[model samples]
Target: MTQLKQIKLIAFDLDGTLVDSAPDLALAINAMLVDLGRSEFSEQTIRHWVGNGAEVLIKRALSGTSVIAEDLDEALYLKAKPLFNRHYSERLCVASKLYQGVGESLAALAELNIPMAIVTNKPGLFTQPLLEQLNLARYFDVVLSGDSLARKKPDPLPLQHLVEHYQLNIDQLLMVGDSKNDIQAAKAAGCASLGLTYGYNYGEDIALSGPEFVADSLETLVELMNGSVTA
Candidate 1:
């Protein structure tokens, strides 16, 4: 793994990396499904469907396991979108929480005078409120939600934009996340990546995705940052 001294800017993927939001997301998704007279998916199912953003998650929920978005009926998506948004708005963070060591890690990073940003595929509507309620809003220099850009993670648009915003070289950036989208986005943006083993990865191992490092808790990252030479 690269030393933390090389990381001038650290970008985090929201849902599974910094926080565990699956429970809340599942509640809203199920509420929408029930409103549509469809069977509700389990929380485990919803967790697997997340990371691609709300639209894709809803589409996957409507289509079931491993189904492509094209398989989802457009009419159902159009109907479910509003319902899901409304439900999620109400349930945001009711059951969600920062993962172990998230607060401490964020504090440690802030103490290091490092600039950090959140690059999440979650819609801005839910993202802002969740961050605010969880008291995580102050930790980030910027927050780029899925709706903030025409494209999100796995596309590199957000990371590229952050590089421009910070006026930093891509080599000086690190992406910390829970899924392959984060790694793919980091690679495409020419940045290093760290993956979390405990976060959702479509039920697969994050290591298989080839991130520079993998750990189960943010405390490990804090340790790295503390041990690394100052940037």
Candidate 2:
């Protein structure tokens, strides 16, 4: 594997790797459920259901647990999606917070003049507002949301788009995220991936997804990058 310093373009998964947006997501989901006259889900439940994107999260919320896409109630999902989007837009950063070392790690990477991009399963409507509200909009050179393309993570479409657009070699980029979708997408796109141990992986360990590197804190990532740069 190429060292982090050798990687020129860094693509990140927004929700778990960069910020802990689960609290805000939970609030929106609960409100949408209440509007639909359904019971609210706890943050813990919602957090595990998040990496798949808002639509899947809502489907899981409405169905009360893990659900196959084909098994979703189309009518209920159609009714609930708009409600969730509206509420999430209003509460974008109410309880969302940057994880420890995120700002520093980003800053260190920026100081190295590495171009960064964000590839998230979040839809553009919610993604833009959340990034703006959290002041994270400045760090990314490119932002690909769930709706930006026909396919999202675990499919590799988003990252492949970046590689083509930036004229980047697969080995020249590093995909950093907190879920299996991220690693799967990276591997499919032929890029190296780094997984965050503390981030949500649908109630599983991130290492099981087979990222090239795994760390519990972004500080550790910065250390790896710095060491590689100096070595």
Candidate 3:
């Protein structure tokens, strides 16, 4: 087994790893689809479409349907974005819940005084509300969203900005996420990454993303971060 190193700052992806937000997102997307006179998608399909932010999600939800055009309709997507946001705000906590042990793990990390931030592809509007709903907002020192920066994950800009903003040593930072975008961003920004087995990976196995470690559960992640787990 690879030896785990001491970590100082921990960054997390919000949607899949921290919260099971698919249900609320699915509900919002389906509501838009219904308004457009289009059929709704299953929760599983919406799960795969998440992690790329709201516009991409709307694109995926409208895929293979007449309501969506071949050429990317900026106007249509923009119009739909606010509708999704409005619907989601009402349904945010109706179905979304933290994965088991997430709250406890976060509390443990907080006790350690480890600086934490959220680096997610989710837009700030929905991300803020959802985190507030789950009661996880106070745990994060910084919340970097897709709309917060000029570029999103897989581009490394977000992580790079975070490292510079925090004045952190790359080796002391750990990025915890559930997808290749997270892995790629962490790698490019020269931070260690831990992938969660349960998050969305867009059909690819997360192991193939070459993260430094794979966390089976949030509890296991807390143990590893606290140095309770030996190599």
lDDT of each: 0.89, 0.88, 0.84
Error of 1 at 87 (Å): 0.4
Instruction: Write the residue-wise lDDT of candidate 3 on 174-230 in tens digits.
Output: 899999999999999888899999868877788899998888677877778667887
* Residue clash pairs of candidate 3: none
Candidate 2 per-residue lDDT, tens place, 135-170, comes to 888889899999999999999999999989899788
On a 0 to 100 scale, what is the lDDT of residue 149 in model 1?
92
lDDT, candidate 2, equals: 0.88
Span of ten consecutive residues with least summed lDDT in model 2: 222-231
RMSD of each: 2.0, 1.8, 2.2
lDDT tens digits by residue: candidate 1, 1-231? 445777899999999999899999999999999999999888987888888999888888888764666656799899999999999999998989999899988999899899999999999988888999999999998999999999888999999999999999999899999999999999998898999998778988999999988888988887777775223
- Clashing pairs for model 2 are none
Collision count of model 1? 0
The candidate scoring highest on lDDT is 1
Candidate number achieving the greatest TM-score relative to the actual structure: 1
lDDT of 3: 0.84
